[model samples]
Target: MTDRDAFVARLGGVFEHSPWVAERAYDRAAATGLTAGTVHSALCQAFRTALPREKMQVLRAHPDLAGKLAIAGKLTADSTAEQASAGLDRLTPEEHERFTALNDTYTKKFGFPFIIAVKGLTKGQILASFQSRIDNSPEEEFETACAQVEKIARLRLQSMIPGDENA
Candidate 1:
């Protein structure tokens, strides 16, 4: 197998759970050498090509508002989701009562947990985005989520083994 062929097969394993993501990863590796920068750029390029229509398919991948029982630990609730959840552990009884109210309100306004790719964001930043985005129209929110999905898929691709030049 040439580099591209190997890239597709091996990457299939990495994204076995998400086919479109596997395809996107394969396309990227084939066109660019499988180095760090190339992997990152390939994600932005390939995702922009494929993601807007695809993000809705993966929206279910995000965690619940309370960060309870999520797939892959982080997929449903990204890092800040988990952190916010952990904060609940530290809250006093009064704070916990207030948190429950806020959580319910947020969930009612947004169909899913407030999402931000927490890889490069501070907890504060995540909070800001969460509040701002909560008011977005469903269409706008869907687009935003799709964009987040692209960023997330790119982060995922970075950790995958470099695609083989030959299979």
Candidate 2:
């Protein structure tokens, strides 16, 4: 594969359902160099500068944490693994019910599923964040959600990029 194609293939899904971020980031890589730092910066810049509607689509593309898609085995492999890492896959019935309720409430409030990087958090921590953010204004929530999305993408990139600490 060409270098660009290989780069995209490796990092395309870092931004949830957004492959376009990786594609644009690859285009920017020519000027910035292909190191992990530049790749991440380009990817976030593409996401940051996206039209508001496109940003909404990206946010909406994310599955609700431990919600229907996850229960039905329809989450992307990355999402499934990330959720599992946070103990979301092991929730009790009570915890599941709480997540379901909060997810519904949050989506109603913000028009997008609640999203947080679940890599190192426990289910309790995720639930707490959900509860806390549900009270944010739409504008505040949008910014917070977008920032969380970038954090998720950064964590994903770090896993795939070797010697990332130095980049």
Compare the candidates by TM-score and give the number of the best one: 2
Per-residue lDDT of candidate 2, residues 2-88 (tens digit): 988888888888888888888887888758777778788999999999999889988999999988999999999989999999989
Residues 40-159, model 1: lDDT tens digits: 566455555665445444555455433444323443223334444445324455644544555566667655555555565554465566667777888788778767765655555555
Candidate 1 to truth, TM: 0.58
Per-residue error (Å), model 1, residue 8: 6.1
The parts of candidate 1 lying over 4 Å away from their true place are 1-17, 51-53, 70-112, 120-122, 156-167
State every prediction's TM-score relative to the real structure. 0.58, 0.94
lDDT of each: 0.53, 0.88
RMSD of 2: 1.4
